[model samples]
Target: MAIIPRLSTPQTSPDTGPARNNRRGMMWLAADLCFNIWALSIAKSLGVDLPPIQIVLVRALVGLAVLIPFVVWRGGMVRLANPKLQILRTMLSTIAMTGNFFAVAKLPFALFTTVNFTRPLLMMALAALILGERIRAKQWIAGGIGLIGVVIAVDPGSLGATSASGIGALFASVIAGTSAVIILRRMRNEDALTQMIWQTAGLSLTSVLPAIYFWQAPGDHWPILLSIGVLSQTAQFCFMRAHYWAEAGVIAPLGYFSLILSVTVGYFVFDEVPSIGLYLGAVLIIGAALMASHKGKRG
Candidate 1:
C-alpha cells in the first residue's frame, strides 16, 4: 500500500522543465513497475490455493469498483469511436489476464518476469504481420536474439509439465497482449479512461462464469485479493502518467529494471535462486528489447 517510498526515492527538482518532467516520469515508472510486481507477488501467494480465473475475477471486479467513482465524476462514459475494436480488445485482454495469472501461479516469479521481457519482440512480429509494418534487419536480429534467450531460459529439456504449461500460458498472454496493443493503435481516438472502464467491465463479464465454476472463497484472504486490485490499478495509472510526462527513451529502459525487483522478490519471498541460464538469457533478452525499442523510437 505504501510501496512508493520503498520502491523509489524522491527525485530532486531539476533546473529545466523538461528535465523535471523526465525525473518525475522515471519515478512514476519505477513505482508502476514496482507496484505491478507487488501485485503479482500477492497473486502468486493466492494462486497456490485459488484458481487463476477466480483471482482474475476478483481483480477485475475490484478494478471496476475502484473506477466507479471516477466514472460518475467524469459525467458517465465517453462515446466510443470504435466499439467493435473495443470488444475485440477486451476479449484478447481477458485471455491475456487469465493466462498471466495462471503463469504467475505455476512458474517461478523470476521466470515469469523474464519471459515477459519478450513482449517487445512479440510485438515486432505482430506489427509486421498484422499492421503491414516494415521490419528492419536490425529488428529481425534483435528478435532472433530474444528468441534464443527465451529458449535458453526456458530450457525445454528441463521443463516439467507445470513449468512448461506456465511458459506456454505466458507466451499466449504476451501474444494476446501484443494484439491488444495493435488494436489500441487502431483506436487512437478513444479516450484512455473510456478504454480502461470498458476493459475492466469486459474482463469481469467474461471471467465471471469460469470463476464461478472454479471458485474458492477468499475467506481470510480477502485483504490480499483487494490489495491486488488496488495495486494493479495504481500501476496502470502510473504507467499512463509516466509515458505522458517522460520521453519514451527515458522510461522504456526503466521497464526492464522490473526484472531486478522480481528477482529480488523471488529469491527472498519464494526462495527461487536464478540459474546461470536465467542470468545469461536475461542479458540477451534485455539487450534485444533495448535494441528493438531504440529502433522503434528512431523509426
Candidate 2:
C-alpha cells in the first residue's frame, strides 16, 4: 500500500510569472503522467483475471474513501459547486475510465495507446460542436493525419486487433473528449478537489452493481488495486493542478512523453513488442496533438 509516494500539494501564487509556472507545470505533468502510466500498467496486470468492472469499482471506492477525509478537512460539502455539471462530467469521465481499463485488460499496450491518439482530434471536433469553438485549417489537417495513424495502429480490419474492447475504447475516447469540454467550463466555477470528490463518488455509485454482478474475488490482488486507487487519485490532482498553474501550450507537449513510458512498460511487463506501424502511428498522433494545441493558440 505504501508503494507509491505521497504527492506534494501544489500551491498557486498570483505573482508567480510564466517562467516559474511553466517549470511547476512541467514538474507536475511529469510526476502525474508517470504515476498514471504506472498505475494503469499495474491495474491491467491485476485486473486481467478479475472482472474489469469489479476492478474499476474497487478503484473508485478506494479513491472516494481517500478523498473524504481531505474534503472534510477542506470545507466539506460547501466546496462542491455547480452540482449538475459535476454529475454530468463525472459520468462521462467514468465511462472513459471504465472503457480504458476494460481495453487495457484485453489489448496490447502500444496498440491501446495508439488508438487513444484520436482523443485530441476528437476533442477539437467536439469542442466545435458542443462549445461552439471554431476550428482552424491546421487543426483539421493535423487531425486528419492523426486519424490515419490510429487507423494504421488499430487496423480495424484485423481480426485480432479489432476486438470488442478495442472498439469500446475507441468509442470511449470520443466521449471522454467531449466530457473534457464540460470539465473545462466547470473549472471556472469549481475547485479541483470538488470535481475529484464527485468523480470518485459517481464512479463508485455507477460501477458498484455491475461490478458486483461480474465480481470475481480479487484475493491477493487487493494491494495492487489499492495502489491503483492511490496513484490515480494523485494523478488526477496533479493533472488538474498542472493546467491550473500553466498554459495549455506548456502542458500539452510534455504529456506526449507518456508514450515512452507506456511503451517501455508494455514491452517489459506484457511482452508487447511494438510493430513499425504502431511506432509510426504514435508519431502521427503525438504530432497531431501538438499541432492541435499550437493551432488552438493561434486561433
Number of the top-ranking candidate, with lDDT as the measure: 1
Superposed Cα deviation of residue 241, candidate 2 (Å)? 4.2
lDDT of 1 by residue, 89-208 (tens): 988988898899989989988889999999889988888998999988998999999999999888889999999999999999998988999998888888677888887888898889
User: Which has the greatest TM-score?
Assistant: 1
lDDT of 2 by residue, 1-299 (tens): 11122355445457863333778877888998888888889877864587767767877887877777876676775546577777777667667777778788777777776777677778888777777888989888988999888777666666364466556774675667467565657467665555666767888887888788888877888887788888887787687667756787777878778788888999999998888888887888888878887743333
- Where model 1 places Cα greater than 4 Å from the true spot, the runs are 1-20, 296-299
The residue pairs found clashing in candidate 2 are none
Per-prediction tally of clashes: 0, 0
- Local accuracy by lDDT, each model: 0.85, 0.74
> Which 10-residue span in candidate 2 carries the lowest summed lDDT?
1-10
